[model samples]
Target chain A: MSHISLFEFTQVVKKTLEKNLDPTYWVVAEIGELRIHPKGHCYLELIEKQGEKIVARMKATIWSYTFQNLNVWFEKITGTSLKSGMKILVNGEIQFHESYGLSLNIRDIDANYTLGEREKIKREVIMRLEKEGLIRMNKSLELPLVPQRIAVISSAHSAGYEDFSNQLANSAYQFHISLFAAEMQGKDGTKSVVEALKNIFKEIDLFDLVVILRGGGAQSDLDCFDTYLMGKAIARFPIPVVTGIGHERDETVADLVARTRLKTPTAVAEFLLNGMRSYEESLLRSYERMIGHTQHRLLNESNRINHAATGIKSLSHQLIRDVDSLLRIQQQHIFDTIQHLQKQNDTQIDHLTGRLSLGLKSNLVRSQQQIYGYEQFFHFSDPEYTLQRGFTYTTIDGKSLNKQEAPTIGQVLETMTLDSTIKSKIEEVK
Target chain B: MAKELSYKDALEELEAIAHQIENDEPDIDELSALVKKAKELIQLCKKKLKKTGSEIDDAMKELED
Candidate 1:
């Protein structure tokens, strides 16, 4: 117990540490926490855990010069920059400062260790999700035929968001996209993404799918996407989720759990547009088929109508011809009957005229005989003829003509026989 | 006619009518009517495909109060 001041003791300890510890030592540990100072120094809490217990912990620092070089070197090797929660093998020197206590001054980092750690974690997450039957959950979801309504989960200020929006906006198909802004990287990224997913879930009916998007980044930026929370959120989401986290190499757990995975935000937009385009093609095809079938039907109907019309026309024509022939036959029959009646009437009139002429000739003959008889009687009774026949009548002074009358006076009478002439008077006796 | 039906429904109906006509089941009168209906449905479907509304309404949580 030397009566020395605290400053003197701190100086002696610092000297002892500088002399005993190696200038640079290789150490393996996990970066439990990390922060960057405004001046470009990186401070870290390095930890080694056994099961759930922290067995060792130490403070570490990388000056701006080393940090910048190491950061570039590490990113070039592993496709990612150093980040918290990553297991790293670092080369550093042990330093003891009174004010800061024991710390390590890091000179170099092994990028392979961090890369291996990320891969291991990703494999574990995949295994866990697979065992829980969630790996294929999102992929099995039936995407809408027209996935036009979209819920976009991304950083509003990120280039990925701009690319996605621009691509969709420029597409020919119309899409309804509602952006749900979220942190895309760092320690709080998982929490923010999960929150955005929850927000989308609340209005699940409004969206056909969820798109998780981010621009190309170092692999370290994708760490939050490999977490169990993110995997679970995307896998179990009611609406299918599509991921375009923009990593060129290894697929993140988010990518594996999504319904569709594309390389970039622009690709995701294209995928959505292609879906709409294919649907439209199908619609056009259906329409074309309908039109073709309708045209065929119309043609058939028109042909049928034409056929019927022709049939009616021919049938009517035949009917008219048949009717005309029948009318002609009837007219011929009526004319024949009229001619026959006229012939019968003419024969009757001829017969009646012949009988009338014969009756007139017979009557004329009988009248001529009667006239001859009368003429013969008159000739025989004539005086000349009586004289020739020697038949005579006598009269005394005309008394012979008054034989039956009493003679009132002697009268001169004359008698004549044959041609003899006598005069007679009518003195008469009985 | 087909304007009352949704694009999907109109297409479906058109398919059915076409099927009927293809089978030659309908009489001339019915066929004519079906053809007319199919024409209307085709027009409706084309309109649906060609006509796009420019109204874009956003309900983003970040934009909402």
Candidate 2:
């Protein structure tokens, strides 16, 4: 077996580290920690992470003079100071020291590359959210007809909140806004905002919507909102979220996931007020239509009634006139019939009276003739005439007797003729 | 508002139409439509009655049989 000295083994390791790496190469890494020594040398802990797990980590150093130049250049280009948690692009050499272990000797950093890295991270977070199906989750939530109750995630004293309040005050609509104070910037901002959303979810019934407002801060502070954690929080929230980030730059991940992304806090307030105004206008229009329809219906109904009344009046009047004419004709006919009948009866009565008088005179003469004839018969049939003609008869005492009469002893008999009479006395009785 | 009305609604519309006609407010162009509507409503009512009468006849036949 062969063994080498500790110094000899370290030299071999040092040679491998040096020969294995390029002289200068660009690296992408997040600054996990940063510090400047009194001597003006900038020390940084460069790290690469997958979610919360650190996959790679390295210590990097910039020389005193070079630190000054790179910091200034980066701040000028990115509008952000060198700080922890920022992804940086640094061109550096890998150095191995027998005593010191391994370190990256950072020579120069590309400020432009840093900016591009930030943009790339932002796009990656968006892609991740889209793949998770959370990009449109919050945006798809239905906004209430009137979002009166609002849960605000913002600093209580932020200038953006102040502007939002002032805008709402100007509108006639009333809104109930309550602040759930949270840090709106820095590394903790994403967590702060996520926690605020959780708190709102717990009291979700009390709010109609959630509004995350941030403004009047350095542009670099808006970076936290572009993170996957912040976007996921807003997208998965049950209630609708509206973001008014008040930035002139492109929309952040939070803005994309929100129900609406307004340019400023004042614009958000105006959106609410305009919705109310349109709803009110529609209601007023409906009321007007109701009145118009009702009045039209009543007018037409009354016209119909008037028309029926006039028709009824004319028809009844015509019928009454017809009945009146019929009655008058019947009355004239009855009067004429009575007059004709009376005239006929009077004529018959007069004729009958004349005939009766004539008949009575004739009957009286006939009766007189009948009585004269009877008197003639009586004169011709007289017993004195008959006896004077040629016949004699016997009488007893002063009575005439015939053969049927017998003489009595005490009777005196007498024969009488028309002008003379003889008397006799008899004694025999038979 | 729909094109087709339910039986009760059709009856009400018919009554309103008759009232409108009695008012004589429709112009000649509208009068043709109004009269056509009246004919349809009357036909609908008669058809309903006919259907009811058939139903009653069926029921009586069932009972007799």
Per-residue lDDT of candidate 1, residues A239-314 (tens digit):
8899989888778889999999998998998898888888999999999999999999999999999999999999
What C-alpha RMSD does candidate 1 show over the true interface residues after superposing them?
63.5
- Tens digits of lDDT, candidate 2, A1-430: 9999989999998888778877888999999999999999999999999999999999999989999998887777775667898888899998877787778889888888877887889999999999999999998999888898999898989999998888887778888898999999887999999999999999999999898998777655678899999999999999899999887767889999999999888788888888888888888888889889989989998999999999899989999989998889888888888888877876676566556545654654464454344334333334454576877656565443543365668777777677887777787876
Model 1: lDDT of residue A122: 88
lDDT of 2 at A108: 89
Q: Over 4 Å off in model 2, which ranges?
A: A1-25, A35-43, A49-81, A91-108, A308-430, B1-65
* Model 1 chain A lDDT-worst window of ten: A370-379
Candidate 1: stretches off by over 4 Å: A1-26, A97-99, A216-220, A277-293, A319-430, B1-65
Q: Write the per-residue lDDT of candidate 2 for residues B1-65, one digit (tens) a residue.
A: 75655545655666677667557545433644765665565566545545655665565456434
Model 1 DockQ reads: 0.00
Q: Count the clashes in each prediction.
A: 24, 2
| Poorest 10 consecutive residues by lDDT, candidate 2 chain A | A373-382
Candidate 2 residue pairs in backbone clash: A394-A401, A413-A424
